[model samples]
Every structure is written in C-alpha cells, then in structure tokens.
Target: MDKSAQTRRNRRQSATFFTLGLIFIVGLVVMLSNVYQLDGLTDTVHDRHAIRQNTRLRSLQQFQAAGGRGVVGEARTRSVCIFARDGPAILHVKAVFERLGYDIRATKDDDWDVLWSLKSPYVAFGERLSKLKPHQKVNHWPGLGSVTSKSDLATSKLLSAPVGYRLPKETDAFRAATKANPDKMWVVKSGTHRGVRVRKQVDNVLKIRHDANLFIQEFISNPFLIDGRKFDIGVYTVITSIDPLRVYTYEEEILLRFCSLPYHPFDEAEVNKYVVTADYTPTWEIPSLVEAYNNFQYSHKQALNLHLGRQGHNPKPMWQAISDSIREVMHAKEDGIREIVRKRFSHQNFFELVRFDFIIDEKLKVYLLEVNMSPNLSSGHFAPNKWLYEQIVYNTLKLVGLASATAAHPADVSKDERDMLVSLRDIQVASDRCASAECDDNCKPDICQLCQLCRTPYFTDSVKAAFLEHVNRGNYRRVIPKPLEEQPSTVDVSKAINSTQNNHLMTMWFRGKCEHDKTWCT
Candidate 1:
C-alpha cells in the first residue's frame, strides 16, 4: 500500500515541474524576439535620417559649386564696370566687389561681367546692352525710371505712393485734391532734382511755372516719429528678373535717415524738418535708437523694431505692410518694365538695385515716397554706415549670383568640383517631368502646359533662378511672387500659360526645398 502511494506522488510532481519549464522557455524566446524587432526598427529610422542628412549635404555642396562658377558661367576673372559719376558715393560698391575678388573697371571698359551704372545703360550703352551676353549683368533695368522718377512715379499713381500729380498735365487734378482736403499740406518736387519744398497754399502751387518738370504730392505730415524726429526707411530692393518679376529687399538691415529737426511745430519753409537730404541724421544721432544701435550693436531694423515694440506698436505688421506695398508697386509696374526689357537683346543679363524710400504715418501705414536708382552706397556722410553699405552690397551681389560663398576663382576651383556641382542640365534631368501618371514624357497635350516638360524656357529659368536665390539669399527676402503662405492655394493656369505669373512654380519648388531644409524658408 505505501509503495503504490509514493510512486503516484512522484509522477504528479515530475509532470508539474515539466509543464512549468516549458512555459518559461516559451516566454524567454518571445522576449528575445521582441527585443530584436525593436532594435531593427530603431536602426531603420536611424538609416532614414542619415540618408536625408546626406541628401541635404549633397544638395548644398552642389549649390556651393555652382556659385563658384559666376552667374555668367566659368570666368577666370570677373570685372565690374562702374559708370557712376558720384565718386565717393559708390566707393562701397567698388570695395565690396573688390572684396569678392572682382576687378573694378572704368565705364569705358567694354569687357565687363557686370555693369554697375547710375542710370539705365540703355541710354548711353544701348548697343552694348543690346548685345549683352548671357553671362553679363547690369545694375539697372530699362523703363524702371517710370517708377523711379519723381514726376513719372506721381503719374504712375501707384497705390502705395501718396496722392500725387505730375505738374502741368495734372495741375487741375492737384487743385481739385487740394480743394477737397485743404488741411493737407503738399510737397512740390522736381522730377530730376532731389530738392522738395512744402507748399501750404494752393495759390503757391498754381503760381509755379507750368513747364517746371515738377511733381506735387501730398505731404505725410503726421509721420511716425522716433525721438520726436521724422524719418524715412531706405529699403535696398533688388530686381533679378522682369518678365516674371522677382523682387527682393535687404531684410537684414535698413537705412534709417532721420530728419535733422523735430517734426513737431511744423514749418513749411524749413527743409531740414521734412526732407531727408544727403546730410540727414544717422541712426546713432537719434536718441531712442542710439543705445541699441551704438552700444548694443543692434541692426537698424532691429533697433527700430525694438523701439516700436516698446511704444506698444507691433513692427511685424508694419514691416509686412511695407513688404506688401513693395510687392504691389512692382506688380503694378511689371507690364511697363517688361515692355522695356523685351526690347533688350537678352533680359537675363540684367538686374537692378534700387532704394525704395518709404515714410510711415502715425497709424503705421507705409507710403512709398520715391525709388532712388543706384542708391547711395557710400557711407561718406555717416562713417558708421560704412559697414551697413558694404554688407548691403555684398549680400546683393551674393543674391544676384555675382558673388560666391567661397573666394576661389573659377580657375582655382577644385578638381572635385563637378562631384559637388549640380548643373542646370542635372536639374533639368531630375525635375523636368510631368507629375501626372497619365502624361507621357514629352507632356505634349495642351493640358500639360503646367508640366515641367512643357514649361517655357522663361518658366524654367525662373525656377532655376529661384532655386539659386533661395540658396544664396543670406538676409534678403523675396517680396514679389509673394511667399507660399501668402499665395493662392491653386495655380493660375492662365497666368502660367501666359508666363505673366510663374510664381506658382517658384512657390512649389520653394515649398519642397523648405520641407527638406527650414533655412530655405527664409
């Protein structure tokens, strides 16, 4: 009886132990398998991140290599011809170009890569500009005078510009405007001369000579003042293309020219109280901006924004308004500008640098006063402004493809340059395709007008330009062909077909680039 009972008890214990061991083995195998799967997933994510980083790095290298080749292509030595008569005013221009390793040539030097002239070269160098090579560039665009000239600007009647009338032709309109708003003061200015005089009485304007080539504009009496002094912002604007119309402003800093006298106790006779002449007050001279600009080393724009912020004003909207105003003026005048450019041998060889003088009212509303062609680049009047002028020139050159990130000349470019270089051919091969699955490679159908394959050379060039600019735009912000967020959600096919608005292509390209690299968003 004892032997039988003992055997049963042993069997029961053995079976129980065997079952527990099996369960433990299975749990261990599952835990190990899960750990392996987790590590594999992590490795896959890391590999993807590395690939993206490599792709971006490669893309940047390609852009840098392309920059090494001057915009006009592989040139051993780049030369800039200066036609500016204002000697000291353009010293910074020469200095910056020299810093970029450009040889400064006299106006007579016909062999030049860039023609940095005070006015449209079409007047004196018409034949040369008409024969402009693909690699050549000019600082002025034809027909820009329509908006730059005081009388022409008044006649253009740009919405951003103050109410204005060209003399003689619109004298009657000026009289009516004055009668309607008698309290508003007006400033009479010569089309060619920078001199401006406030005209309080309508009789004074009427008494002026009819053929004086003068432009009468409403005076912005209630100016937004800093330290009780009136001021105007000199925004350095650049136009790279005219057909599609690309415009940019130097966003890093702006030139702040404050009136020599306070704006209060208005005096029509005192020119210093209103006009920001060549002898205008500098930023360091303004009490509110002195500390930030001089001691804190804040840029003029930063200092101005800080001051405005402290005064309970949001500078963002003010700046955005300013940008919007600039875009509007360019868009409004594009047809005229394009018409002039079309007469040229090649529009691709031209670019422009102008200073848009803007005045702000007490309500922070921005008004375009004038567009100064070949803006004073010298800091001869204000020594501290030398840095600002140089930077503006340098950044402008970079943005326009006249300057490269590296100082190496084309001949000195490394043998490995091709590896890093992304040529136009490469871009075309990679990007020139229809996104629609149903479309053939040629994109021959009429509906394929928007396709990259069917896009005109102008459209393609615009996209290429936009890509290069996004890469090299250090502190400049593109205003025309507005930022993607500000554009309509859908492309305007009609505009694209007409090539009047290729901004959709640029916006799409920029959006993709921005997704890959946030820095491009700027």
Candidate 2:
C-alpha cells in the first residue's frame, strides 16, 4: 500500500537538489562578469595615468629649454663654450654652469659652427655695447652685443663697406698724428665714437670699412674734469635671451685714466705773450668746459682744432653717470633686440649675451663703441665675479627645474610664508632700489677687488705690455691667447709652460672684431 508514496518522495528530493545546483551556477557566472569588468576599469585608469605622467615630463623639459624654471640651483641640458680671451665674462658663465650641476665643455674656438654643433645655448659676445636703430634687430641682445647679418647693414653706413675694407688694419698715421699734436682733438673713425685726442689726418686719413673685422668709431672730445684727471664710464648690461631678448644695465663702473705724463700749468707771463692765448674752463663749469673746447677747435685745422684746449681738461676725476630713464631704456631695448634677432635670423642658435661698450662726449652725447660676443671673464674681469656667477647658476637651475626657492627649503617654510617674506622686502626697498640703493647710482661697481677701477689705468696696449713684461719676469699667470688649433706652433703654448717659442703672443689688432668678421669666418 506505501510503495507509490515512497517513489514520489524520492523524485521530489531529486528535483530539489537539481534546482539548487542551477541557482549556484547562475551566481558563479554573475561573479565572474563583475570581476572582468573591474579588471578592465583598472587597466583603463593605469593607461590614463601613464599618459598624464608623460605629458608632465615633456612640459618640464620644454620649460628647461626655455629657461622658465624658477629654481635656484639645478643643471643645464648641454655644455656651453665661451670663446673669449680674458675678463670676468667667461668665468661667470663657467662658475654658474658648474654651480648649476651642468656638464660644461669650455672652448675658445672662433668657429661658431663648432659651438653651435656642440649644442650650446649661444655664444656670449662680451665686449662693448653697440647702438642699433629702433627698427634694427640683433641675434641676441643688440645694445649689449651685435650679430652678423646682411640686414643690420641696410642703415648702418659703418657696417656697409667694401668686403675687404671693414676696419682698416692700420692706425699708424692716426697714431703719428696724435703724437704730433698731443693736445689736439681728433676723430677716431671706427666702430663707434671713442673720443678725439688728435686731429683727423687730412691726407693720410684712416677710414674704417665693414670688412676690416675691426671695431671702428669716432672719438669725441671728453672735456669733463674730476680732480683734474680724465675719466670714462663703464656701463654694465646683460642680454638674457635672443628670441625675446632683453637688455639691462645691472651695474656701472667709472674709470679715471690719467695721461701717462701730466702737464704743468702755464705761467702768467707765458699766457700773456702768446698770439693765441689758451682759454681754459674751470672744472666747476661743465657747460663752459664744452664752450672752451669748441672755441679752441675753431681756427685750427681739423687735427689742431680738435686738440686745442685738451691740456686743462687732461686731469679729470672718475665719475659714474647714467639716468634712471636710460637704465629703463636699456632694458626695453634689450627685449627689442632679442625680438629683432629672432625675426631676422630665424635660427635659434645664433647668439645670446651682448655687452655693449660706449663712451660719452663732453656734450653728453652717447656713442656706440663696439659689440662683443665673447666678453672677457677671467677672475679679475668684472663679468665673472662671484655674484654674477651665482645668478648664472640660479638661472640654470631654474631652467632645469631641479631646484627652486620652494623646493630648496620647502619643508622649513610654507609657500605663503615665503611669499610674504618677499612681499615685505619689496615694500621696504621699493621697486627702484630693490636690488640695492647704491646699485642704482652710477658709481664704479665691479665684481671684486681685482676689478676695482684703478686711479691710474693703462690703455689696452699698456695693459698687454705690462702683463707681458710681468710674464717675462718668470711670473706664472693665466693668459688667454688664440686657440692653439688656430695659431701656429710658435704662437701656441699648449705643449709647454712659459714656452719661449710663444713669447710674443699676437693680440687681435683692433679687439675681437676680426674674429667676428663674417667674411673671415666664412
């Protein structure tokens, strides 16, 4: 009677077991689907993060290349070669590059192609500043330097000359004329207005053309007096970048160069007996000094007239001179020069730093002197002083993004705290004197004691002569000469120390202009 009931119960139990197995299988499929989706999401996030990091790295590299990093100590991307002979300019760049942790390769090669090929930022022209017209452009900073270009010559009569006639190789006649009329005012026709100390030669004129590879300028009469010694101003400026180039006169130094021999005052009896009595202006009357100078030049021939009243004005004093407006003008001009250089050359590796040299006449007229790409940068030279080198390091670091004011001591001070400190300093000093109150003035400021302006300074030749004499006396000193590769074995000292074979190192005749002469390099 119970057989049918037992069979139905067994079937029921089997059905329940099968139903539980199906539910379990469905749950397992759902869990596997969720796991796969999660894995895909994780991979997508990782790829996005990788892309972001790559973009960030590229951006940082770009900033470094553009000198946009705001760090104080860092490294540069490549080595830079400074092609200079002497002075502080080269040292400053070298020191700064080292401080910034860069791998530097210094060279004195006049071949710019080698420099460019080596992947340098740009070669610094470390000489005097040259004046450029408002519309003119330069490769780097123009007023602080000059770049070689056919276009810069369109308006520059001095730059536009016969290929072989740029700067005349000889100043013999001019020197003789100056010696003949020791006190006469003369025209120095070369790169810029230097100053007149002798009369212009009527027949044996020294005409400076563009291809002479020399710096030529007109030498105006400097009649100002300071303690009875003649002096000139050494204005310091810098051009940071060429593409959007900038120029600035961060410092000025005055040089009081007394004549090698001083003159005695004429006696009263001597003055009364002369047909052409000398009219001397007292040092106090600055304007009268100019008038007296002009009066003396009136009747005499060009050479004699120029030298007429220079005797009384001989012993001038050292004085730094520049207006605040001029400083600003110089800075603006620097930017203009950079923009112009970029537009003109369209080559990124043309030039960088330019130190423009200038000399002012008694009339306070500013005249361009010469343009230097490779300025002097030995320790004694002002350009490579410790302070300037520090700046170079700071800029290089900022470019590389390795160090910054924030990163250096970031843990010690909060960003707000650091900013507040800077803001407070800005308030205390004001914008004009923020760098330093004395710095804003025209005093002769230089790098170190070695470069301190001398009370009695020697001309370039004199310095070279004195240095050579010192060297001949068994003195061991570093002297920059033409690269050993360029000079003959007799002129090169690389093989030996104090080699007698290279005793008389030949100096560039007129300065570094011959080296910069475009045709010569070609």
Candidate 3:
C-alpha cells in the first residue's frame, strides 16, 4: 500500500510541473510578439516622418529655384565676404548681413555668396569675377570712372552737369570761356583735391598746374539757401545692369549736406560758404530744418520738401528734373560702361553704388555737381545718419538680390517667375512671332530681329534681369528707360540715338508691361 501511494504522488508532482512550464512558455511567446509589433509600429512612423521631411525639403528647393515668391522654409545659411578691411564704414553692411542670418566669412575666404569691396574690384579681383558662379555678387562695376572721374564728367558735356572744360587738354577753351565772361565766377576742381576754389580773377585759374588732372567750371553763384546756408543733395544711385542700362535711385531719403557758413556777402575766400566738406553743417543745426528734423522726426527729404513747399516751391518738378538729369548723364556715358562690361565673363555678377551730388539754384533748377564712387556709408560725422546709411545698404542689397526679407535664397535666382523672357524658342508666343507672315525663323529683317523670336540670349537675359530688379526694388526708383507716359516733355526720343538697341527694346517692354499693369511702372 505504501509503494502505490508514493507512485501516485510522484505522478501528481510531474503533472503540476509540466502545466506550469507550458503556461510560462505561452506567456513568453505573447510578450515577444507584442515587442516585435511595437518595433514595427515605430519603424512605420519613422518612415512616414522621413517621407514628409524629404517632401518639404524638395518643395522648399523648388520654391527657391523658382524665384522665391512665397513663404520660405529652412534654408541653408549663405556666406558674405566683406573684401574690404573691417571699419566703421562697412559695419552697417556686415550687421545687416548678420541680421539676415548670413555667415560672415573672413576677407581672405573666397567661398562666399557676396563680395563687398570698398572700391571697384574689376582691376584687382577680376579673375575671381570670371570664376564666379551665377549666385555670386560683387558690389562694383568695371568702368565707373567714366562718370565718377571729375575730369571725365566735366568733359562729357552732359546737359545736367555745369559747363566745364578739362585742364591742360581744354586749357585754351577754359581760358577763352573765362575771358569771355570775366564777371562770371569760375571754380577749379581736381581729382586729387576734392575742395574747390572760386576764381574771380584769371590769375587764380592760371595758377592751377596745367599738368594736373583738373576741371574748371562756372560756379553756381546763386545757390538756393536754407536759413542763408548753402547745401547739396546726395542721391544714392544703384546701377544693376549695364547692357540695358538699368539705374535706380534711393527715393526714401537723400543725404543733405549744408555749408557751415552763410552764403551771403559773396565770400570767395571762405570755402565753407560754397563747399560742403566732411565737417559741413548738420540738418539739426539748420534753423528751418531743425524743427522738422529734430522735433517732428521728419526725414531729411520730407523736411526739405516741406520747407520748399512752404516757400512756394513744389518739390515734385525739381525731383523729376533731377531724375531726368540722372537719366541723361547715364545715357551720355552708356557707351563707356558697355565697353567695359563687354570684357567681363558675366556682367550679371557686378553692380554699383554711387552718390550723385547736385546743387539747386535760386530758381529751384537742379544741377549735377559730381558723382562719388564708393560714397561714404559711415555716420561718424553725424550720428543720425547711421539709420539712413544702414537703410540705404539694406535696400540696395535687397534691390540687387543679395539680401531677402524672408529665408535666404540664391542671389542669382531669376525673378522672371512668369518666364516671360525664358527660352524664347520654346515659348508658344515666341514661336508664333517667328512663324508670322512677315517674319521667318531666321528673323533676317531688323524689325523681325527685335521680336521675341529672334531676340538674342544677351537681350533676353538682360530683360529678365531687369524684370527681376523691378520686382525686388523696394524704395529705389528706376530713372532710365522712363515710361512713355511719365517721360518729361523736354525729353526727345529722336535725340536719344546713343541708346543701345537692347535699351530701346527694354524701354518698349517696360512701357508695354506698365500699360498692361500699372504696378510695373512703379
């Protein structure tokens, strides 16, 4: 009886152990399956997330490539190389680029989207310009001396500039002109010496070294005064293209420099009475402008406009005349600019910023005095000018596509979003024009050559560049290629024979665009 009981107990113990093992194995299998399922779910989420991220990046790239019209996403940080030495003059430029989220590279670094040099780099860094990618930009044009050079400008005979003659070369002419009008006050200016000396007597004119690079011109005796102080207006001008010759002037505010001394009593000896040197009087110091500028916080242009308006002078006509004069001067010097641009590998890589100084007569007539290349951007002389100079740089960069309000995009992104000038041969409109009854595919006739069908790639690219500029220009106003409706009555189209064929075409294109959409005019 004891042997049977022991065998039964052993069987019961074995059966219990076997049941426990089976339950433990089942629980382990279920747990492993749940873990695998969780891992698979995470993998799916990761794949979905990657797909979404890639799609977004692709869309952003496409948007940027298509001229950056809409909202932007995360963009690769671009680099700016300030080629000039670090100084107060370029501090605002660097700060603005930094504010726009650009990586400021050392001056020695060649890998940069922008190269901002203090002077024209055509002679020094020209080889770099040839190797520049479409996205690269340099802040200077090649032959800017044509207008900036005092001697060249004086000899240009531009209607806007005062009557002048070059020294040594035109010495006889200058002597005869001064002799003809002995009573008229003449001034002698040289490239090396920025200051001018009024010469009432011919002896002072003869004293000037004949070999020196000098210019002599009739001085504006009756200068328009504010509180008996003489002043000159400095208009910031930007030239974006040379082939079609696009010119823009900062319309927001102009740099107003007033003489420290009074203009009355006819003091030829006191240079401060006639010239606006670096230490010239500030707008805050001028009685008539101080109230509007200091108290009311009015801009220099606004305060000047107000003062002029109150004195029975409308600033609109004066500004328009100034704009016209700018256009005429550019037109007069277009050939020289084009000649220099023709030698460049890519003209699109270069742009220019200059200051056009003009003096106003008592009758509100504007006269172009001189053009300053690499004009001072520093506000060390006047603290209030910091804002104005910074804004000018920001706007100029925006206008030239160096900086953007939104995410940074390639500076060379074609703004021809409408593709108006893109691949004329592939466009249906261009195709139709080529196949017109009066035209052949070759477009042999001059009239047919001007059509889109036969337009050269250079002209097409120039038009595209111009259209892009027009889109990006914020406060800058286009002065050249004036719209037909807005053209002053004094401008004679027939007399503008020096204008290039491309310029004429651009004028027509802009005129047509403005007619169809008034926004293009602006």
Top candidate by lDDT = 3
lDDT of each: 0.76, 0.33, 0.80
TM-score of every model versus the real structure:
0.77, 0.34, 0.85
Collision count of model 2: 64
Best by TM-score: 3
Candidate 1 residue-wise lDDT, 1-522, digit = tens: 699999999999999999999999999999999999999989999999999888877765675665433332334777889887757878888888887888988787787888888666777886878887666788878888776877777666666778888777787888788888989988888876566899888898878875657778888889998888899998999998876677889988999999988877888888899888778888998889999988999999999999999999987777877777777667667777788777655778878888988999998888888888888877677889888889888888898888966544533455355334434543342233346554565555443544555768777667677768766888898876666545332222223222454554555555555555665555
The weakest ten consecutive residues by lDDT in model 2 span 447-456
Question: Lowest summed-lDDT stretch of 10 residues in model 1?
Answer: 489-498
Instruction: Indicate whether candidate 1 or candidate 2 has the larger TM-score.
Output: 1
Q: What TM-score, to 2 decimals, does candidate 1 have?
A: 0.77
Per-residue lDDT of model 3, residues 1-522, tens digit only: 699999999999999999999999999999999999999999999999999999988876787677763344535678888877788888888888898788988866787888888876767675777778877888878777888887778777777778988777777887788778878888888875466889888776777776557778888899999999999999999998888888999998999999988998878889988989889998999989999999999999999999999999988888887888778778888788789778766788888899999999999988898898889988877889999988998899888877664444565334453454334432222334446777764567544655675778787777766766777788998877774556453433347533787787777667656756687776
- Can you give the lDDT of residue 497 in candidate 3? 37
RMSD of 3: 4.7
lDDT at residue 274 of model 1 (Cα atoms):
87
Between candidates 2 and 3, name the one with more favorable TM-score: 3
Q: Where is model 2 more than 4 Å wrong at Cα?
A: 1-89, 106-184, 189-197, 206-218, 241-245, 251-351, 360-368, 380-522
- For candidate 1, the per-residue lDDT at 31 reads 93
